[model samples]
Target: MASRAPGEPDYQRLAFRYEPMAGRGERRPVIVVGAGPVGLAAAIDLARQGVPVLLIDDDDKLSQGSRAICFAKRTLEIFDRLGCGQRMVEKGVTWNRGKVFVRDEEVYAFDLLPEGGHRRPAFVNLQQYYVEGFLLDCALALPAIDIRWRHRLTGISQDENGVTIEVETPEGTQSLACDWLIAADGARSATRKALGLVSSGRTFRDRFLIADVRMEADFPAERWFWFDPPFHPNRSVLLHQQPDQVWRVDFQLGWEADPIEEQKPEKVMPRLRALLGEAAEFELEWVSVYTFSCLRLDRFRHGRVLFAGDSAHGVSPFGARGANSGIQDAENLAWKLGLVVKGLAPETLLDSYDAERVEAADENILASTRSTDFITPKSEASRDFRDAALDLARDCPFARRLVNSGRLSVPSTYRTSPLTTADRDAFAGPLEPGAPVPDAPIRIGGREGWFLDEVGGAFTLIVFAGQGALPDTDALRPDPLPLDRIVVTPPGQDGDPPLHARAVEDREGLLARRFDAAPGTVYLLRPDQHVCARWRSFDAAAVAAALQRAAGGEIGRC
Candidate 1:
């Protein structure tokens, strides 16, 4: 279902009401709160792992916000793993570059997470409503999914065994119990607030007014940031393209201007005209004025109750990292939860979820806050220096590289995570197995083609072409050493590497391209396409170990 924008809060009924549970209801394994991208993603991931999921939303209706519009490639890869990649790529706009300007002149432009030696999943521009709807559809298709709408959570209590939640429903107040709980609520997350988690960081003094407008501007569909606006000398304007033939424009409103008062079309339309020329004809789709802060939870997990998405960290929306990072938190948590619940991995694995993801979350917050400082500096001298750099970087590639690298949202790696398990028997050196493995060209045995990613091979297997070398397995695993279980292909394969999917290697004998491992190295990739284990040389022992590991598991290996 398509949702209306943030302004049309015709969303019926107050946010909370009282309800009561009178009878004994069945308990679920996992109960997820919030139906937004982060919550929904966690629910869907759990459901896919064969864990029953109960998804709760404050209001029954789909959200209406231009809330999260841009998804980085790593995110797209996760969607692909969930069977929605092609649809997203096909339905959304693909962008490669973005530009920065000062006084109407181009100053800095750069790549968004430069291609990691392969055709990466492109950064897509689609409304948050559409993304959620798509994910909701996927969740419904799963046999174990239960999405509860109009369910407002008022309180929570947890014991070692499970958790109980107090929710106000349309009917009355009630309590729901589950083995695990994930609060994906928002920055003002009731869950985080309830836990009394200490969040650090000050809210920005300057508020940003964002509007989805229809205008005949000649600007390219890529992201455009301004160092200093020509109209508002003290503030800046940000322009980004969106679907539905509309664009999103943001202006700093000096913290004191009221959003409700600014809703007057007469006042808002003229400001939009300030960005696009006066001749540009446009209509407003939605307008919002919100403030952001660089706050983070003192802890992501407190006992059995866990926090995901904005419930965990809140980043300034400069690089479009907030929502994407939250969704990733869901991905990492859901899989580990599945393992622990199924008795596949130890509870120790769960501890790593908070430790690893919090690092990633902190990085996201730091990156976003830095981006915010670059575009909307708080100090007067900093603002002046920022403008001068923009003015001079117009023709300087060196300066452009410096500015552009920061804007591109690169895939966050887990090199420092405690959960990023590296084993010498299965892995060599300091390779982070849980990291998104770089793309490699390889040969498959079945078809008469040389291209990789055949059958959507992003997180699939890689086969060595000739001599059929045995690849030792068990190198890359995040934690608890599943042995054979992982979404990434292990280095060993039963049959000869399919010629169609073999990585083309250089003769001097190193991989010249991204996947260029030495000859006879069969690599297995994870769902996020990270290299798990690779075979320096494959043999019967390596192949047998992989098969043995695959057979002994609650999680199926395909």
Candidate 2:
């Protein structure tokens, strides 16, 4: 076993023994299995909030492959919170177009840019390996996190005080205790299986041949697909560009494969040539065959064990929603877990994690299922319908619009969520309270324009047009919690809004309408862009009480 340097990010050669904490380091708050995106995300979040986390994974090195490439704007917003969005944007390609071909002929093309006044929806195609490395680097740098590789979770048992995890390491077997455990060990999750969680979803009849290649081709930098795929001799093919000139190529295995014929790259290349014609000169970086399946665990949390990422939900990689959804899983669960570990909210608050995340994971499954269904449809009739739709889309811009947008990933509005407002007319329509606040760019003090997300962190109190005095956030504010920067839009007026809540110069609803505010309405937005609470206008007492309740406390004390 090896150990990482004090500040060196990569810890591949390092391992830490689980010494039973008896004195200073006896009880840990959480133990997370799997060092993938979701696991690392959870660890970082807990560490940020001063919780101790021990992360375990079997893999020693980051998995290399352009597995999941596309990241939605919501995912970017999440990275923004963690201070990584700028680097991601700088390192990835923000795609806005896609092309579809039928029988080697261009059939349809679509623009993905947001229409109307919607915020620009851009997706990045970065190799999953790089992303993990970046996140791992960030996570391990924190003093409260310890990531252990070559550790496979074999058994887990929990009691009243905490949970115990049995791991098989190179040296020997060991047990670690913690307040809770997160199972992010992928679809064939050992942890989920141990808890007897049921996951059910259909496997597609056809298989897909995936080839990650470094290609310098004439094709534009976009998601390129060939319909009526000759490679499959039935379905179609897709190509996604990655950061380093690598492309993820997928072709449906239309015909029953002869094990002998399927093994040869020559066979696959010939078929690819038939489709690409002159453009087939592109080089193949790596290739493998993967089966497409859609599955979701019956539960996202079980006792002290919670599942995120593929362990909670599995989707075909066609739409690349899998990892993005998992990252979101971390964002939601992390905050709640932070509060629970801190004793702000009851452990029962963990139940809502399953409820809300299960809904979002279902959304991801449906979207990826649809994308898979469209690309490698089950029935011949369905395949024909898909082709015809693409052809028609080429002729009609309206038809192309939907295909192009890929339905742009929108945040799930937890309308029925226990964490949401049940008041019927409390919040505005078109957007939900617990959903990602639509990007409304309002100029700050008449100088520059920034979107709603740029309004800074912490709870945002959105005061509608011409409202009243600032709520007595101090009254309800929890002890050690800061609410001093509360921004009030005012009782009525058209002026610039302050950058931070506490910096207003006595006038402006600048950021309120940026979030689509209405007069006589007050909006409270959470750090993850969800609505926490709201009112008609700012009332010192009532608002303070609600804020107190929202803070899970009285006048002061978290």
- What lDDT would each prediction earn against the true structure? 0.65, 0.67
Worst 10 residues of 1 by lDDT: 482-491
Residue clash pairs of candidate 2:
2-14, 3-14, 21-26, 101-227, 213-285, 466-491, 466-492, 467-490, 467-491, 479-557
**TM-score for all models, in order of appearance:** 0.81, 0.83
Model 1 TM = 0.81
Give per-residue CA lDDT, model 2, range 1-558, as digits (tens): 122224644323333354323332356788889988888888887787788898889757775555777887777777766656666777677787777766666657667664434333567777776677767768868989877777888888988778888878777777778899989888789997777677899887776777776655555678787766555555667887776666677777754755456647896677667655755556766667777678988888778888999988888876667888888888788877887788866776677788889988788778777776667667888777666677777677665543421334556776666666544355445665566676544444544343543543444566554544444444444345434344534423343444434423222343454445555566666656676666665555655554444444421232
In candidate 1, how many Å is residue 439 off? Answer: 3.7
1-558, model 1: which lDDT tens digit per residue?
Answer: 133455433322223332233332778788898988888888887877788888888875555766688888777767766767666677676787787776677776666656444344447887787787777778879878777777888888888888888888777778888888999998778777666676787677777888888655567778877656686566677778776566888887877888777767887888887777688778888888888898888777777888888888888888777888887888778877876677766555566577768888778878877777766677988667666666567776666544521344556676654433243344444344556654433323433221224422223445444443334333433234333221212233224333323333322212223444444555554434455445655544544444233222312332
Query: Candidate 1: how large is its RMSD?
Result: 6.5
User: Looking at candidate 2, what is the lDDT of residue 215?
Assistant: 55
